[model samples]
Target: MTAQTAHAAPSTTAIATDTAGHGTRRKVLWGAQILLAAFLLIGSGLPKLVGQADAVETFDLIGWGQWFRYVTGVIEVTGAIGLLIPRLAGLAATGLIGLMAGAILTQILVIDPAWSALPAAFAIVFATIAYDRRTETRQVLRSLKR
Candidate 1:
């Protein structure tokens, strides 16, 4: 190797180390995000979808009809499933994140502050996935040419 090459900003070993660290962080974040999604789907989705006792009451109190809850529940379930798949995981996270953001606004504007949990939890999960899989997010953006 030439002297210039030897003095390159990132040596091979340095690049490898950086790559490994990023990979580890990515794996950890993705795992946590997937777990969060599962909780959202099971804890919130099922009850809402089935119109369980408390779930029905809760939705009614929030002025969100049973049909609305059912639709959101289906979306949550689909997003959770998408999170498990590598190819569509980014899209899933994005969709869920958007949904959660809407929920947060609705809670603040239309409902009570107590409903913030749904958005708060979803925000954390969304951030985790976005931060960990930034490369994928970037690629998607690039494809959109935006």
Candidate 2:
């Protein structure tokens, strides 16, 4: 006499279908994040890089000089590119969050309190992205630990 029990594993077809759905959702979210990054790069980063009058004036008001403007512009451009990369998106968002926080503080103390709202909104957006991609960020950190 023999006793046997059968355990059923998930079908490959079902697993593939579930994975496809997740991929589609991720693609949509990535597209939206890239679009927002493009806007930030073009609208804010470009002006700072080119020494646009307003950007220069704002940096002057911040008392950080033109060098700071260039540095911030470079960081913004880099972060924008990083946002398009799946492995780097969360880290990019984290950096942008810091940048936007500084912008918000600058607006409140040096510029105008009313001007802070835009940067505050940007910070929130970056935070959302970072939180959403936290798993990827943790993976990156773990890899770096080695």
Candidate 3:
């Protein structure tokens, strides 16, 4: 082959390098995000759902009482499941964040000010998931396109 023809094909080394770089970056990002999501889901989400645990005490302190804790627990469990499923990730983030937002506001307005820290923790976790799911959020928005 002529010199020009030889140069036309991409080098195998370059292609492999690009592919490896992309794969590694993807793995790192997915690892961090999935770990964060799982922590919030398992640590905060499931226990709240089952009601055997007493993180529900925090809600009770916020004046939600036993009945309200059960209701919030149900919503949290559903939202956690939604966060795990890719298609529903955006909605999950929104729901979880909304829940946290209400908790934060209540802590500020109705509950003791010290209790505000608890909802802030939830907000941080919810925000992390929401930021990580930006691509999914965009896909959700794009689906509304004509």
Candidate 4:
């Protein structure tokens, strides 16, 4: 075989291997996102919906009333569901980032200082997910513009 042909074969194989690795990484990330969504829905959303003691206390601290708690709960649940859908995950993550930002601000300004980091961490995670899915988000926005 020609020397050039031998070099070209390895280059093509490397590219194929690199693409497969990327696909595996993407699947792992997608799985993690799904798990996060499920946790948010079950752990946070349900408690608020049911008026759990801690959730009630948190709303009291926010001073926004029970109605606001219900609204926030609904938003969380909806966002969590949206996160499971490939096409909507970016939008869902964006919405979660807003919610987490509010939580972080509240923790810093009104609630306990030690708790602020929790929401900040969640905000970072949501931001990462949003960044990763930016292309899908752009496509969604483009469709809406039409």
Candidate 5:
């Protein structure tokens, strides 16, 4: 390898996957987690927490009473916080996937079926993150036992 070549930036693929396949892979997952967390916290969770009119209206339609709205908001905020923590990302994603599943079902059964697709798409993203970080999740579980 020439000195000039050594100094050159690594190719995208080289930067993307290391010998253990954990280079850009982790970064991509991190980025996705951040984006999703932001959406959940700011776009969805906050409204419910603050009792925004739209959120109140939606929960009213769900017919579960306003308390359920606060419960969902707290769950979402907690999950979003977990997503930002390195060791907790996988578990957070798994939890969020379950939350999304409930959202999907509620949309289909209580609200317009058309809204279910949004949660379905989010569930897929969370699934990807959960699968990718399964090893970290296992480590977290092991640590809890010790």
Candidate 6:
């Protein structure tokens, strides 16, 4: 193998790393995204939107006021919807990861530490989705540059 041939492979890697075997992987990601979206929209976001007792109380403990709850609900709902959009899933998952981090911190600091488990679990799932869709995320960013 010539030095030229050895170096040529590295140059093609960027353009060649397409979704050759990501069909099954992507399907799995979609499944997770759907489930998470439903969970967030129904179990979490809606409760905050409607001022469910538990949600209201939790935010109360955080001492951020009920308005913060509304903002959080909006972010959750928006992120959930974005998860279902193929082009936005990566960015959506990335955003959710950040939201979950805040939740985890709140739970540990102001609320029950045990409650942190839920958000931590959610963050892990979002991380996986974000990682899987990174290439798509990059493509989206590239398009936005125009």
Question: lDDT values of the candidates?
Answer: 0.78, 0.88, 0.72, 0.87, 0.92, 0.92
Q: Rank the candidates by lDDT, best first.
A: 5, 6, 2, 4, 1, 3
| Candidate 2: count of backbone clashes, pairs at least 3 residues apart or interchain | 0
Give candidate 3's whole-model lDDT: 0.72
Error of 5 at 5 (Å): 31
Local accuracy of candidate 5 as per-residue lDDT tens digits, 62-131:
9999999999999899899889998898999999999999999999999999999999999998999899
Deviation in Å, model 5, residue 14 alpha carbon? 10
Residues 20-109, candidate 6: write the lDDT tens digits. 447767888899999999998998899999999999988888999999999999999999999999889999999999999999999899
lDDT pick, better of 3 and 6 = 6
Order of candidate numbers by TM-score, starting with the best:
5, 4, 6, 2, 1, 3
TM-score result, candidate 5:
0.84
Q: Best candidate, lDDT-wise?
A: 5
User: In model 4, what are the clashing residue pairs, if there are any?
Assistant: none
Where does candidate 1 have its weakest 10-residue lDDT segment?
128-137
Q: What is the clash count for each candidate, in the order shown?
A: 0, 0, 0, 0, 0, 0
- Better-scoring candidate (lDDT), 1 or 4: 4
> Taking the tens digit of each residue's C-alpha lDDT, what string does model 2 give over 41-95?
9988989999999999989989988999999999999999989888999999999
User: Model 1 residue 74 lDDT?
Assistant: 89
User: lDDT of model 4 at residue 93?
Assistant: 93
Listed per candidate, the RMSD to the true structure in angstroms reads 3.9, 4.8, 6.2, 3.6, 6.7, 3.8
Q: Write the per-residue lDDT of candidate 4 for residues 1-146, one digit (tens) a residue.
A: 99887766557788999999978867876887888888889999888999999999999988989998899899889988988888888899999999998888888888887998987987887887888788999999999999
- Name the 10 consecutive residues with the lowest summed lDDT in model 3: 27-36
- Provide the clash count, candidate 5: 0
* Better structure of 1 and 6 per TM-score: 6
lDDT by residue for model 1 (1-146), tens: 99998887977899999999988987886787678667867987777788889877766876867788888888888888877776667777888888889789878877787978978787877866866666776787788896
TM-score of 2: 0.79
